[model samples]
Target: MSGQQPGRAGNPQVFQPLAADDPTTVAGYRLAAKLGAGGMGKVYLSYTPGGRPVAIKVIRPEFGEDPEFRRRFAQEVQSAQRVQGLFTAPVIDADTDGAQPWLATAYVPGPSLADAVVAHGALPVEAVLLLIAGMAEALHVIHGAGIVHRDLKPSNVLLAADGPRVIDFGIAYAADATSLTGSGVTIGTPSFMAPEQAAGRKVTPATDIFALGQVAAYAATGTPAFGEGTSHGVLYRIVHEQPDLSGVPERLTELVTRCLAKDPEARPTIAEVIRLCQTANAETVLRRPEDWLPSSVAADITVRAAAPAPVQTPPPPAAAPAVAYSPTAPVAPATPPPGFGPPQQQPVQPPVQRPGTPVPPAQQPPRPYPAPPAHAHAYAPTPFPAHQHQQQHPQPYPGAPVPPKSGGKRGVFIALAAAVIFTVAGSATAYVLQKDDGQQKQGSGGSAQGAEQGKGNDTTAAGGAAAGSAKPNAKADPKPADFKAINLTAGYHLTLGDDDVRPQQGEDGGYELSYDTGGYLDAETSEGNLVLLDPGQEGSLAVCRAETRFAKNIYLTKLAKGRQICVSTGTGHMGLVTVQGFSPEGSPSEYMTLDVTVWRNAVGTGSGSRS
Candidate 1:
């Protein structure tokens, strides 16, 4: 083992690039070079001698310390093998019980959502709508299989030239399984998590919807829903506060707003989201993205060939082709022996191809050979059967659920914690609510009656307003010619509960801001700009005060990273508002406020109370 350097730049051993000759084979496929690295592991550009390419992921050393993590990792690998979708990066190979466990999937060529936003700023409204619809469709398939991609954020979304594809199901959830991150800590990125997930409660499809909303916010404003902040601060806001959507495009604001709803139940289903996005026409998507092609093809026909062919019963020895090698030919799996607790999983062996055959078109780039049939490997129950192939521990095949090891300390602790929390939290709330029901109902009813009367008065007032506008100078306030000319600068403070970064000031004196809100707040600016966040529970409003007239519009677009800062028009008047508080579950952004607008008339000007 090499000695490590603490934090110096020239730590010879830190992130050294892999040499061409370095052994990087997985299953029978050889790794050609290193692609990139992240928190969990290093990603390699691997290919079979036949030329098929794959992106292989190798787990990092730190994660290996926890046995529980390893177990969960192995399970996730198996589950990934079961996923089948054109938009999904399907698993091609894996070896969970090897010295250094590794998994491989067909390589995808595209920019991540984060990279796209950084390079191109926000996408056009139409493109954003397509992105949302495509992503929602992808999630529909994944969630249906009973898997929850606990970490769905911009980085995880790959915007291929053709369309969007989701990657990294390393910590995905199965239909009936506990999350890899148990109680006492959060797992997925803080910004993209649903409110309940932040509270360490159970997560479901609604949680995914919340994450999608954050993605959409990024599309609109080049930011997340909760705004940029420390992971802790972002989580705090997601669980307790609302998002600020001042600049989101009117077409996508509603869709993105729904995605950011705090109550998971209130969020739309993935399929519904897809439909809404398609109909929104927020912006037009470009052409379909590129697709993968088989690595090798016959020179004359251009026909595709399989990476390596599947195993078949051997016939006469004389029938063997020159390239043919027996399974017992003794090729070692890539990587060295382990020094850790248990051995990592082994990679699958590459299949043997038939001589002179053209590669199948389906075996192209994004597409690889179909996954190994269930139980293709003989090392299920026991991870490493290398030195001795034990017979008694016959393991179930891949796709078959692995039983939880009985009585693991971590499992016991989790179960106990869950029991205690549920009993107290559930019982206490039920008891209190039931006891207060009678008095609460009476008060609630009275409030409802009063609210109705107030609505009637507002309607009457609106009618009078319309009539007044018809006749000039009827004592009604005149709409200003333009928004107040406030000279804008760089620093402006806008906060949701407690976020650190604030909004930037525009050269024109106006400020652009955005926030993620699960509930609506009829916020009145001291200067007369009225902004609404998540109106009616899951809605968005774009408010801007240009001159003396205030303008607003209801927004309706699914969460995508390209629809923020759209102008407010059509609904009432005309003004521009930029998105404000953007945050995701795992990686939320910081909140920013600008000098935009203020409502002239509202009953309460002091207390931050709800209407």
Candidate 2:
């Protein structure tokens, strides 16, 4: 596959630097990176000498020389020129009769529908509806020009921050063009083809509707309507069998079923489809909110930067609640992050600094009492609400102990409960965290061990020793904490996708969230702030006690608009970071912010994700 991937360079890693064999420029535009390559030819990410981004598909040598293909290509280009729709990636420029036969379309910055579903499973019902409607609208425009988009499938549709866009009309034909599928040189996909197209019969606009049914089924159920198999079998099923809508939702079954009808006249027209979609979804929004994609798929939106563009503000510090411990204390009077162990020896001073010393980002120093090492098992005491007198550190002087109470039945009950609740006659302040869908299980990504496995090899800093180093005072491995969460929408949704929300640079040693692909969190630059971490290494997240580096595998997939993730500010305070939401239906406010709850001091709780 040599042709430029038309329009999308969603995966930043896939955008390879220009090769020696590649052209310095195409037509007049300068080629930046290779977008895609296939049987057709290489597609390059280019800039019009005017600096406009475009996916330029340069046809392969063999196809360009075919006399028959040349005529068909020229006519299709003319047909493509007549299409213009909010949902279609319009063909802005082309030269079908030129030496290489190239075409350019406006760039859509998110992953293709296929890539999104493959990486994150089925899209939500609302997302699928919007997709169907958008594609239907695009078809309305496509057919208006008398063009039949002969090659319509998931990959040809991109999930942009704005909406879905139809791309790659490589096999499209004018209403009167010759067949491109008959006589063995099939240009369209078999699983999604119309019966007429599969039987080498006349192709028409309804051909696209059939494919739309297949695409919708795939989007809603994460599988094709026609089962997967060899080319011959799939096409055979398309021509003579009933579609399997088993996984589709009930309301949509009727709609897609009609589109997949074997008889062209029986299929719904593009206009009818738009009307049906709007009627069925009268409550739906014509356009999706900015946080339209899951973080995993959003990470693949590489046409622009996808990282959060926050200013370089030093993350606030975590406040150490008032509490103190004595030498060789046991699990007695302290509240911890969860999964903490009782003290085994002399009181250990947590790494807390005076007001003048600089602190790291995304972290808070553990209370200045005996604490466990990164891997040490910890005993978490119940939250001790502030009010009762308690020491902030191991006190040099001892405190009084409460005598067992003796009274009547009612007073006896109170005495018994007080004995279980109090220790050394003290009360301490407790820190409260929000909880939502419990700790968001990480995203369904390439690997679950990415972060957990790394923690095993991570060096611990307790007792002034690195993770693997031996320290006589190193605390034993603390049991992981029960991560807390809350809906990101609790803080009214923040719409940062607008171009006006530019990113602010950081100050010395402050927290910074960066993205390899641009627009990650620069809502304007990248529809949202989504950073795709390097696949094999530790990522930069200011979790833990200030400037704690996060492991690669702990990231979540979908981040909703206006959601905030709170972590230890490494000071005595917690830092709350909010990422923009892009949910199509704008409900269930999922926060896509970097979730530090999963890794308080890199303990690695709830490290896996559900697909």
Candidate 3:
């Protein structure tokens, strides 16, 4: 592939002009231009007080509106600040409490590995080796601080003149913290995900090792180890099939294979990965050459590094007087630079009036100008003039009476008659509805009283028919025996030892239940008390009770919302838990909300029916 391309003789294609809606300054740093935007937010180019370039990622406004996201974002920023590796972009500053959360990292002025690989073909074997070594070292330092670079794709690795720099830990969470995965969301790229991660299992430092293998393979072959297609298909292949490392260099095949092992434990550790690279380089310390990257990649990096500094526009003088404009005077429009001017518009002409007619009052300007079109391209130029003016027009006062139309009296009479008729009809309907509601409430009260009186003898109930009959009613409104809904955050424990099931922060008690980041419901000490029914088997509590085999934990991977779980609590109460839904991914308080129904003293009797 040809690497030679046009240099930055003028403005570089990488640096885009700031749009009108884009903020020119965030916190104290003056934003120079737009670097790029992603799902999380926009990244702007800025400078520190010392004139060092930095990239500021301003989070999207919607995310800032969520208090849970703000908390997690602050935690991630703190963890990122602790990353002090040579080959990683360190977070130098952040403001998580601001209206728009943002964090700044030392800018690495170079093309990303994905960009370089796309521009030029796969790198030489030696370059790939060096790349792997640097990344391995970066991960070593990151994992040491109890962090996992969860999303370690090629695009996150920037190739600098010195070496590769890992960046963008936006999704990275603490190793011991809860996994960010939730229903309908995947934390990492499918092609780079370890088997466990793709299967919704627990993620550890070894997960990053699997990603490192994928990155190395992609860098050597210009394609992912798992061929790309739909995300589901790719994830399936990552979990169930071997990687396609045919095009990868022969020297790196064995090491890449080990790294891409299906079992996380089978993959080499980060330190071992570094040692493997050294061994590949003839059993000596791997040192970077002057031209560690291929010639074309090196030239691209040089162009990016040598890009001229952006020109800073001085703020407008505070004391300048507003310029006045006369309607009768003709003025020349100022010329704007190419690709940076507003669309042309035809001038509006004044209406001619009779000689005896009085002049109309001057109009007021519109309250707010229309927002920029949603379809406008990111690179579309906005109007850039020293001053802008709006023609003002008079506005009618609020609540002013509108002129009557023809047959106004007839229309008013019809409206009044319709309103009176509707009012009478509504009152009559309310009276009838209230009467019916009172009757239904009386019937329900009788049923509740009967149930309370018979509670002592109702413990010995059985059969699937009774449970199935009550299942439909449970969806409408849970019965009196149902426990209050419980919300269990990841890494927290839930105990059914008491009459009320409540979530505990830690697994300090010998409880029958706890949730894990892997989407599993586990019974820490009370094994064999929890049973997960098949999809269609959920309606029958008898089947749950008769189940001879029980697992210590049940995986919720791919489990439908509102699915039910059966558990015999430590207090000899049989309960049915209906999972409502999981909290949004990346939420600081990621939790699973469950509605539970309990049958007191019904565990060993096989007598607990939903009814």
Please give the range of 10 consecutive residues that has the lowest summed lDDT in model 3.
Answer: 1-10
Of the two candidates 1 and 3, the one with more favorable TM-score, higher being better, is 3
Residue ranges of candidate 3 with Cα displaced over 4 Å: 1-12, 170-187, 307-611
Q: Name the candidate that leads on lDDT.
A: 3
Question: In what order do the candidates fall by TM-score, top score first?
Answer: 2, 3, 1
Give the CA lDDT, 0 to 100, for residue 285 in model 1.
35
Q: Residue-wise lDDT of candidate 3 within 474-530, one digit each (tens)? A: 111212266555888877886655556688777535666778767788867654367
Q: Tell me the tens digit of each residue's lDDT in model 1 across 276-328.
A: 77668632332332221111201101111111222233476665346633222
What TM-score does structure 1 among the candidates reach?
0.43
Clashes of each: 101, 77, 7
| Model 2 lDDT tens row, 228-336 | 9989999898888898888898767778888888988899988777766766667534555555566566656543333222113356897765764312243444333
lDDT score of residue 2 within candidate 1: 5
For TM-score, candidate 1 versus 2, the one ahead is 2
How far out, in Å, is residue 427 in model 3?
99
